[model samples]
Target: MNPPNVQYISECFIKPKSSADEDETKQPIIHLAPWDVAMLSSHYIQKGLLFVKPSSMNDQENTVQPLLEKLKESLSLTLAHFYPLAGRLATSKQESPPHYSVYIDNNNSPGARFIHAAVNLTVSDILSPVDVPLVVQSFFDHDRAINHDGHTLSLLSIQVTQLIDGIFIGCSINHVVVDGTSYWHFFNAWSDIFMTNNSSISRPPPVLNRYSHVLNLPFTHHDQFVGRYEAPPLRERIFHLSAESVAKLKGKANGECQTNRISSLQSVSALIWRCITRTRRLPYDQETSCRMAVNNRTRIEPPLPEGYFGNSLQIVRGIAKAGELLEQGLGWAAWRLREAVANHTDKAVREWMEEWLQKPFTYQLGRFFDPCSVMVGSSPRFEMFGNEFGMGRAVAIRSGYANKFDGKVTTYPGYEGGGSMDLEVCLLPESMRDLESDREFMDAVCI
Candidate 1:
């Protein structure tokens, strides 16, 4: 590629000829949250660079564009498939309307806000530091060619780049329409179809139906819900964690509190709050909350059919204080975390979701809470690592998007020399570094 030139491409507009006209056969890609769609556009346009190296014929360098177009076209056929992996922190209201947007909506960014995922192929011209920004900008700039109305629909910038030599493919999905697995299934299936010229072999039709008849919650009748976390001004640092440190935190928390059903994740999060409070050294009885994300798929009956893409995550928070969470050892915080998660999960959690599932788009989750809230979300339940066509089994796989909130946390079970559970974890950068530096933090989780 010539030394990249950043051009604000000449733009044009199109009034798709009576597109959604009286055509019953044509399904609308539902616009879950127009605000979130816009938020993702603004965020990804700034840093959504996911480099991909061509592997099989479908991903061959010369043919990437057509495949990209095809993927978007297919995805556009549903109402629930607009923005890719976007999430919202709006104050959670009394009801949970079809939550499908995958993105974070904090008004801040000092570090990158891209949603990076890899395809593990080797290719030339992987982006170098100086030019990374330029290449990343190109993907969003060319949105016109991809989806002209990308801005309007919250499906703006996305980068498809070559990583490694030609054995790996990196992709930064604009956290709008697709979440983690949705992108995997979408791209993998697209590759499967393109490689064979059939869009349906072993592919399942996407389930975009959010039937009102099914959501039988006693809603507050049009109660407007604002987001839980308001968009904060960009921070000087980006919030992301590496897999190595997450493992250590889990071990440290375990060392302190040896208990049942106590996930390493909860322990690590508790430790994070504890450490941050200590460093900041805040006062006693000062409360804080960790926004815990829960996937409602398995919890829901019939377990939404495979490939049923949309926002399926729900938030349950772990509450502790500036003094309590801060002063307590890892074990104490971990125990409290365990209780918080467990208490919400009993019988009340399901009913809570049932009701919250019917709220309006502006639903803010913060209205229902306390102090020092840290938002968190997790990657898919199980890794979707078997979409291989020719390259040997995947050697590595993990999420590329960061939580991006001031006190945000998100994780994925890392893949090392693994099977069902050699769990590797990632955390916000600062917290991870703290875990590595502090011996107490380190020993608490037994890292």
Candidate 2:
């Protein structure tokens, strides 16, 4: 399969609308919490590509010279409110605790990288869901080009790729700055501005105070989590589960418990966990864990504001023996997954934060090679199809990161909608081969 040819037209930084403070020597350096600092060692950046149909000439009197022009203009205006996206993460060379903070030095650093490019392809070609990695790579630069050596920095990167009958909005955001929720918030905000042709619409102002939620960690724990773990070679495959299949899975998961009802997320995650374990042929007694990304917006005490940005995420893991999860049925695994999610309450989040402050980076520091662990990310709640920019809503959406870790799962809303889900599953080549031929897994997935 040949990769799509994407021609890079131009690359320039989109500065904020107001550059009056560019000459100011003293700038704000937003402090980061322990959770934010932990990601620095992992060096994981979030990348996604959104595909929108071609704009109808009648939609906007066709007055907007080009879509890229409007996008850049609106993005400049949008960055005024979300300025952190325009900044970089860095540390002042202090003798004591390296002051790691978001540097908003306007004179020294440009806001975000915006690339204008085009591809010779159609919307249908992308929506087909084949050659996904090739298409994704052509549009987005997941290289994390920004130097993260704590000395040099660049935070966000945006690339607007134009197709024959569509447009692709590619974004690469540093994981230290924002999580999934904040990622979509900035995206939707950009779309809203472009749609309404008004930068002053009723949008939730972003909360930039990184110190608001502090995780005071000990200085000694700084070196505790340092080494970056290498992952095994993996392949990415997208599995679509129809709404009917999801309902059946949910029903089966709930059947195990007479009292508690299992959620769609829990049911779907449990099925993936079981399928991966069985496909890998892991020993029956071998312990495996499913780490689900939990948003702490509502789980935090008093709850964060409506548009509080930053990394407000925590991964909750559900552990069980490989044989136990595969043998016990979907309900049993779902029950365990449900309990893991339920345990992330307001108090639990606070306690977890404090506990993390003690050990800090011990969790993800050197565990990338753990084949027994599956990291489930993304949520159907953030429906990418509903994201309507000035031209049109996104027909297909995908992440650009080549998830190197084995057993990593990312979920998105399927084309059929109505609770249907598309799981972008990544695993070792051998395990993926087994999973592709697994009868039970195939029966549950909608072809």
Candidate 3:
């Protein structure tokens, strides 16, 4: 049998013909800045679901229908203020971080937005237990395009099944329009507003107002980045952390280190670092970094408002010499990693953010971040994991975003009482083999 096919379908969208002399006209929504279009397109490549059984769901949710209405209304009102970056995706020429417009076919009465391609995910649990259903989903093919005919753009298709329970909705909002804090607030508000009527999402607070629009700001400053930088190459691989291993690493080893403040994530991260350093054969004291991402919604001074959107993020990096990281005890390694992450909310971080926004290459810098870096951060913080229709608590959740960097790890907690952690690590496959071989590191890991 032939291997599974990665399907693709493309269609052209033209703006409504404005006059007899012209065949078609592209809609204004398609003219959004290329930088802005990317903010909307990157969400597609991030994470594929490991659908866990949900506790509950309403089959008749018609969730998308209601959402469509809200989005339309929001777009109209939102476009008035954000036309520079709203409507369809933009089409830019860069590929490391791809960019394209969301074409529109205005010929349709509703001015359907034209997408160049569409991906159909056929969901079936044919190979799984009879009780499970194969839940197919579609991934719109609009990663890169040009001359976005907003009039041709169409609705993004989404489908859910009763057999599956939890979902990991990872979004890649343009940094130009939102930061981490702003994005989550928008997410929280989007959920709240959509879940019920009369639910108002407050406007995002004023965090980053720095914009050059031009290559030159008031006073321009540029510097070379210190760390090794690479782009995150896409691939398919399961981030494996077996149940038995995690338990032993987390403390199944000895009775002495029992009853501690260490969470599974912290313990696992430390072990991962030590094992990685050992596997890589790096000398002690060599400056290596472990980075993690932290959401700043609740951390902003005066607190940002509910609907704030834009890039509000902090890269917490832990650093220690190869010798210190590997030779030191687990507690020492964990502490070093934690301290490196301590900068998650320093005043300097905000200054760095403001400085970055003032940069013309902010997007370019984002594109340069590889997945193989020796840093890790827990993401898709699901504070509201209670939004399930049926099935049961999610058995696991994971993220497989391994950019070109060295050590990339993320942890997602299961639903209440969902015992094991769903840890996702995307590293060079060869390096992973070495990680698995480190018995000392594995023993220190507390799952």
Best by lDDT: 2
Q: What TM-score does structure 1 among the candidates reach?
A: 0.57
lDDT per model vs. reference = 0.42, 0.72, 0.40
Q: What would the TM-score be for candidate 3 when compared with the true structure?
A: 0.56
lDDT of candidate 2?
Answer: 0.72
Query: Alpha carbon lDDT of residue 56, candidate 3?
Result: 37
Q: Which ten residues in a row have the lowest lDDT in candidate 1?
A: 9-18
lDDT of candidate 1? 0.42
Question: Residue by residue across 133-222, what tens digits does model 1's lDDT show?
Answer: 223223332232211123333333233343434333334444444444455555556345544544354667555443323222232432
User: Candidate 1 or 3, higher lDDT?
Assistant: 1
